[model samples]
Target: MRLTSLFFFFISIVVFPQKTIKTSFVKKTKLKAESIVSVTKSSNYTSLKYIDNQTLFLKLNDSIIYNYSNVQLGDITSFDAFSPLKIKLFYRDFNTVVVLDNRLAETDKVDFNVVKPYKNVSHVSTGFGNKLWVFNQDSQQLELYNYKTNQVSAKSLPIQSNLIDLKSSYSSCWLLTESYLYKYDSYGSLIYKIKNENYTTIALDYHDNILLKSANNLFYLTDYNQTIAPIEIPKLLIKQFLVTRGSLYIYDNEFLHEYQLIKD
Candidate 1:
C-alpha cells in the first residue's frame, strides 16, 4: 500500500503543470537616440542598415561615413560590421562592398563583377564566417566570396533559396525568408531551420538562438529538441527586437523593455 501510494503521488506530480512566474526586475539605464547624440541627415532619401554606439555608416550609391556623435546614416541597401573597428558596406548599383576601418577610413573595395565570374551580382548578403555569401542567379547556387583574398567558391543547394534578408551575430548567420528561419554556422554550412507558424516577429541573439514573438507569447530556441522557454513581455505590440549579450531588449511603441536571461 505504501509503494502504491508513492507511485500515485509521483505520477500526480509529473502530470501537474508547472507554474510560470512573472516577476518584475529592475530596469537598466535606457539610452535614448535623441539624448545620447544628434543626427545630421545627409540625403533627403536615406536608409539606415546598422548602428553601434560610436558611428553611423550609411550606404547610398556610395558609402557615407557619419560620426555617431553628430550625423545619421542614410539610404543604406546593406551593411555588415565586424566590429566598431571594421565594417563592410554594400552599394547595390555599383555592385561593390566597401571595407572600413575604425576611423571610417576606406580599407578596400570589393567588386563582385570581377570576383565571381559567372554569378549575377544584383543581390548580396554578408555572413559572419569571414566570407560573403552570394546568391548566384545565373548558376542557381550559393557562392562564398573570400573578401580578404578575393577568391570565390560555389556550393550547390537542393533548392533555389532567395537571399531575402540576412544578419550576422558573432559566428552565427541568419537568413530570413518569408516563412523560414535558416541558421548557418561560421563555415556557411546550414545548421537548422525554424519554420514560421504564426510568427509575428523574431530576433536572434549573438549565439544565433532565436527569440520568437508569436501571438502574445515569446519562445526561446536553444536545445536541439527545440524546447520552448516562454517569457512574459508587456501587453503591447512589439515594434523591434534587439538582443545584445544576455539582455533581450524589446522596443514597443514609445517604450522599451529589457529582460535578462535566466538559465536554470
Candidate 2:
C-alpha cells in the first residue's frame, strides 16, 4: 500500500507539474508597415470607412468623401457605410440591412421588421452572392435573404439550440451554436459541422479560412473540406481578428498584430 501511494505521488508530480510560458507584453507604437494610411484626423472620429486598397471613406457634416481615391460617394449615415460594397450592414437602431454599391450608392434596404418570417431576429451576417444570413428568434432557424432579388431561403439546423454567433466571407458562413460550428454555403445549405472540444470564438479570415480561438490559443483552420488541421498561435490570446487588405490583423487588447498568409 505504501509503495502504491508513493508511485502514484511520483506519477502525479511528473504528469501535472506547473507549465509556464515566458511572454513579454509590450505596447507596439511603430508598426512594421510598408504603407501607413490615416483614416481619421478629427478628435471625435465619428465616421470612417476603408474600401479596397486606396480609398478611405469619411463622412462629415452629412457629406461622404473618398479621401484617397478623390471621389465623392455622397451623403450616407455611419451605419450605411458599415456594410459598404459587396457587404451588408445590420443596423441595430432601425433593424434594417443596408446594401451599398461600388460607389457607395444605396442598392437596397432590407427592413427586418417587414421581411423576416419570424418576429424576432437574433443575429445577422453578411455574405457574398448578395445574401444576408439571419438567425430568427421565434423559430430558431437560420435563413438566407437575397436583398438584390428579394428572395428568402431556409436552412436546415439542429433543434432547440440558438445561433450564438455568426460570420460570413466569400460564399460561406460560420454559425456557432451551443456546442458546434456549422458551415453553410451561400444558399444556406448545411455543408459540415465541426464539433469543438471547448466553447470557441469563431471568425472568418481572408481566403475563406476560419480562425478558431479557444481560451488563449488561436487556431488557424486552413481547409475545412479536407482534414481539419489546427495550427496553434505561439504566445498571444487573440482578442479580436479581421481580414483587411489581404492580411490578417489580430488584436491583443493593446495593439494590432499582422500576419501574412501563405497561399498554396
Candidate 3:
C-alpha cells in the first residue's frame, strides 16, 4: 500500500505540479544584531535565532527571549521549533537529539549510539503525534519515527541522492537533495519531486510555496512548469534566509531584514 501511494504521487506530480505563486516584495523592517549563530522561522509570524556565547540565546517574535545551554551533548548541529510546545536540538557529532519545552527546559533526550537497533541519524525534524522525522543514514531513508516508543512507524523508500535539507510541518515533509526536491506525506509517501537547479537550501512557507536559495541570491519557482524567478531585494550579504506566514526574512551575521510577501 505504501509503495502504491508512492507511485501514485510520483505520477501525480508529473501531471499536476505545484500551483503558480507570484510574489512582490515590500520591505517591512530591518534590525541589527551582533554575535549571531543562526536563524529560523519557528512559527507562522515569528522568527527565532541564537547569539554566540557558552550558552544558547534565543530571541523569539522579536520580544520574548530564552536561553538554553548544554555542553555535554557536543556542538549543536541544528534545531527545529515549528511546534509552539516543543523544540528539537540535534547534536550531530554525538548522534543525539534533545527535546525541549517552550520554556527551554530539557525534557527528553535520545542517544542513537546507545539505543537499540542503532541508527546513524543524519537529520531530524519535529512531526505531529509525538513523532520525529529522522533521516536514517544507514538506510539512506527518511523515517517517521515515534520517538516516545523508540520505533519507526513509517519510512520512505531508500533515497538515491545526497540529502541537503529536511523541512517539515505537522502533516508533510520536504527533503532537499543535491539534484531534486522530494515532498513526502505524513505516511511517508513520495508526493512530489522537482529539480534542484543549484538551490542549496529551501523553506516551505505557510502557503506551502517552495522558496529556493543559491549561493548568490534567493529565488522561487513561480510555477512548477515555469522558470524560477529571483526575489528582488537590495544587494546585501545573505547568510541565512527563511519564508513563513507571507514573509521573507534574510539575515546576515549582523543585520536581519524582513520583507512582506505581496503575492499576486
lDDT against the true structure, each candidate: 0.55, 0.55, 0.76
TM-score of 1: 0.61
lDDT, model 3: 0.76
For model 1, residues 1-264, the per-residue Cα lDDT tens digits are 999999998898668743342424435323332111111123464222334443454433235444422223233345555353456666666567666665567767777667635346544555544567665567754556677866665453633444455555555555655577676665657877767555555565544566766766776766364545566566655556555555666655454566666655
lDDT by residue (163-245, candidate 2, tens digit) is 56777665777878777778878767877887765645666555677766667665556554423434433476565554443
Alpha carbon lDDT at 244, candidate 3? 62
Candidate 2 runs further than 4 Å off: 1-84, 102-106, 116-119, 224-234, 244-246, 261-264
Worst 10 residues of 2 by lDDT: 30-39
TM for every model, in the order presented, reads: 0.61, 0.61, 0.80
Order by TM-score, highest first: 3, 1, 2
- Roughly what TM-score does model 2 have, to 2 decimal places? 0.61
